[model samples]
Target: MACLSKSSTFSKTFGLRNLLNLTHLLKIIHRMFYK
Candidate 1:
């Protein structure tokens, strides 16, 4: 954490958020498909 630059850390966390959102979206799609 301390080793990273602010912008780099921000982008990293932002990417993680995107990944989480993608997973959540996939779950929703799966539910829709099953239904």
Candidate 2:
């Protein structure tokens, strides 16, 4: 049970970081278009 919970939390954090990266990429794309 403990191991399962740990893996779940790890995945959650990983997904959050992925989402942040995606947003950061989108922002860069928008800037490129505007320029």
Candidate 3:
């Protein structure tokens, strides 16, 4: 049970980090196209 909870937390953080990176990538692409 403890291990499952830990894995879930890890996955959640990993997902959030990926989302942040994706947004950052999108912003860079937008700037490249606009500028």
Task: For residues 1-35, write the lDDT of model 3, one tens digit per residue.
Answer: 99999999999999999999999999999999999
Higher-ranked by lDDT: 1 or 2: 2
Candidate 3 Cα deviation (angstroms), residue 29 = 0.3
**Count of steric clashes across candidates, in order:** 0, 0, 0
Give per-residue CA lDDT, model 2, range 1-35, as digits (tens). Answer: 99999999999999999999999999999999999
Sliding window of 10 residues with minimal summed lDDT for model 3 = 26-35
Indicate the TM-score of model 1.
0.84
Report, for every candidate in turn, its global Cα lDDT versus the true structure: 0.94, 1.00, 1.00
Residue 20 error, candidate 2, Å: 0.2
Q: Which candidate achieves the best TM-score against the true structure? A: 3
lDDT of the structure predicted as candidate 1? 0.94
CA deviation > 4 Å runs, candidate 1: 1-4
Could you give candidate 1's per-residue lDDT for residues 1-35 as a string of tens digits? 56568889899999999999999999999999999
Clashing pairs in 1: none
